[model samples]
Target: MNQTSAARPLVSFDGVSKHYGSVVAVHTMNLEIYEGEFLALMGPSGCGKTTSLRMLAGLEEPSEGEIRLDGQRINEISSIERDTPMVWQSLALFPFLSVQKNVEFGLKMRAIAVEERRQRARKWLERMEILELAERDISQLSGGQRQRVALARSLVTEPRILLLDEPLTALDANLVVRMQGVLARLQKELGITFVYVTHSQSEAFAMSDRVVIMSQGRIEQIGSPKAIYRSPASRFVADFVGANNILSGSITETGEDLKISTAVGEFHCEKNSDRDFNTGDTLDLVISADLVQISMEGPEVQNSLRCRFISEEFVGSIVTIFAELEDGSDFKVQARQRDLANMALEEGAAFFASWNAADAHLIGGNGA
Candidate 1:
């Protein structure tokens, strides 16, 4: 168990459900967010990630159940009284206002004195390393600078919990990475809870201490990024996480060494204690693309597939090879560019994809 899990949760959504008339935005969500932890709500559009965040921020009220803060019921709390300031995707900064005044907006709303609010805003601006640009207009500042200003405004109140909704979406690639570092560092320095909602998997996996995967207004899974990536709890999670090739098959043999029969071939997998497998039970086999190896000649591995190369995608040092299996299903293999430089890879060329049984995981099996 995580140490944070052992501690009392700072925020709890107990049997929470949100319904917008006949449509369900969130359903029976039971989640505990710990103090000072950076938690990300991740999913595709309309997956209710944003709705969940909005509920916690008091922007939307749940149709059923309770939203608790520090063991007290706060479902009816207004957004301002909740102390959960949201940094929106738009930044929502006033274009005509100077950066300093923009950062002071939140404090000003709370009826804070002019001098005190200015001091607080300036303090946060310095912390965000944008004090020099504080006097400039919002339009004059860069995207990253504007982001800092928005963050400063949100943090000016020194709220115990902060909400962010795709705050880095507008920045360029390089700026996005830089802001990710800034957010991570800021979260660590402040030791306050950060509830971030984003559809980008890279952002969630890169910065969050824990990620909540949602789909169709329901929580699919909640775990560390590594855990969810390595061992997806459901087929939706496996597909959404990417880099995973799921093969549907039926169990041929079970117990210590589990064997599954698929269109490609029979493959062995390690039995997991969390699930029970029996003969003739149907299941899905999940193999990560990075764990798979491609070669012209077949290697003596527990699992092997002869696939025709479809394409190769290059991103920095990594290369992802897309191939077609015998059943016409897509298979992917990810490797370092240097590792496959010697191999003469061509489109439509056949290659053997292999991985050890230990690297293969089973999902959708009986008793799962």
Candidate 2:
């Protein structure tokens, strides 16, 4: 989305790890951030996303392996020496300084000419559309305005790479959306690599060219938003990515397609991967909620189940129907709100659930 290419990467992490005493904050992460690419690092708390970002920023040195910038080793470099600028989640700005002065602070520290610094600051402020607020105090500006100022400060240096650590966390929902646009525009216009860190999956998927999902000090998967969401590589990814209904059962048939027998019923899944399964082998099934079809009439489907309706929730234009199987396991079906109105299903009502063979995926048959 940001005019990023695969020909050459601007930043590379080769088997990088960071540790603090007995705890391993980051464990052997290998990643590449392409030039002009908008990459997002997303995970739960203590998942080592922030630690990985810090290592790239030179705020933390890796305990092992190398960190490279433009093919140059930078593991021994300090934050000040690097060309990467980071906008912290807290937006660490000088509270007492006016917007103009705050934006010029980085230029001043680097000893750029006074006139040049002011001119550059004013230009960036104009580009950010906050030139009129140049004299406004940092505390006096709105959350969105302050966010722009923080970005202006980091970007005024025109670094080859920009780093953001949840810069919109403190903003309200509307402001967060607006800020996402600002970042996307900046990256596209400047054609610079952006490394963004956040805990929100929606934010990551909306802004990044690729999303690096981390868990427990390891990188779970790195792929485009669509690939990561549509075809999760593991059970943890499937469960964490979205509202997926995971079923555990024994495989009755194998090869190109698989037959799984569970407490609810016997289901067929399209074998989408090279991983093989044998007869009577236990396997886990990942079926995205939207893949589950809801219909008034019982139609033929490769995988169908008689489920009891537990509940239904309407979110905007989509409706999520919650159901339970005979085994008491939870199942969910997502459908358009308009369609659900005609289905006419009530609590404790029984409905038939069905999915196509290709909709189900076989993952981790041996308790993975």
Candidate 3:
């Protein structure tokens, strides 16, 4: 994705690092967040995505380095003092108070007049489409309703920055998709900076303008969802972003086009030939399952491999075909069940798997 020069970053982290005792939770990192952009921090558990979000929310301070907002240092700013609000995963609403009262709590804390607070609270509740449940207690609302209430409470304060920590994790699959739409609309309408933390790739990719991928307390890569998925910078990113078929190979020829010799066969991959590998260097080729095409007979393609089908898994709309190469290395091919049935594939059937030259990505060094 191309960076927009018109939008200056509202928040910036310079050499920011955090640690608990001797255990480093976040290593020295630098990032710039554009104003009004929806940025998602995504990674596995213990990757420090959540910790970095908390640090941005002022819930924790870095052990070293500094954090800045609009060029002003904010490492010492308190959570409440900063122009930011956080929505927790649990939708932390007061069970005793009605939805309206719950949303007004922030306004009340700010010492707004009771009459004005009620008017603004009701407006925000209506805006969140929860006005019908204004008088209903938290216990009486559904998961989606409770989420709206929590969002109303945070947004009622008119904060410039919003932090969400897996806010949709508690909802069912259908509700999660619905809530994603709600959040996306709200962010676009408000034009506020949103820093969302989640382990779900779909959630992050669907709503984020950019995604920051973390691993082992360090940033693996930062790019748009399409960029990261299509051209992962590392082996970890390739495996993490999507289901990739990682093939080990050595570079036999290089220059404008690169040739890799693997146990399965020799293939030409068109990517990063200038920087990643030399003539005799070994590398890992990351091919996405979706990119691999299965055919009963071999086709004339730049890269084709003959493999035997091992198993198949049907996942609603798509099917996963697991196959083993001649050397016993396993890989997966994803296709629609209709296509799989049309191909009349069997468990022990021989098939040819091929992909476009541009689809193959080179990642990692010899050891990888």
Best by lDDT: 1
Over 34-62, each residue of candidate 2 has an lDDT whose tens digit, in order, gives 88889999989899999999999999999
- lDDT of candidate 2? 0.88
Give per-model CA RMSD: 1.5, 2.0, 2.0
lDDT scores in order: 0.91, 0.88, 0.89
Clash pairs detected, candidate 3: none
- What are the runs in model 3 whose C-alpha is more than 4 Å off? 1-3, 272-277, 365-368
For model 2, how big is the CA root-mean-square deviation? 2.0
Candidate 2 worst ten-residue window by lDDT: 1-10
**Rank order by lDDT, top first?**
1, 3, 2
Q: lDDT, candidate 3, residue 124? A: 96
Which candidate, 1 or 3, would have the higher TM-score against the true structure? 1
User: If candidate 3 were superposed on the true structure by all CA atoms, what would the RMSD be?
Assistant: 2.0
User: For candidate 1, what's the RMSD?
Assistant: 1.5
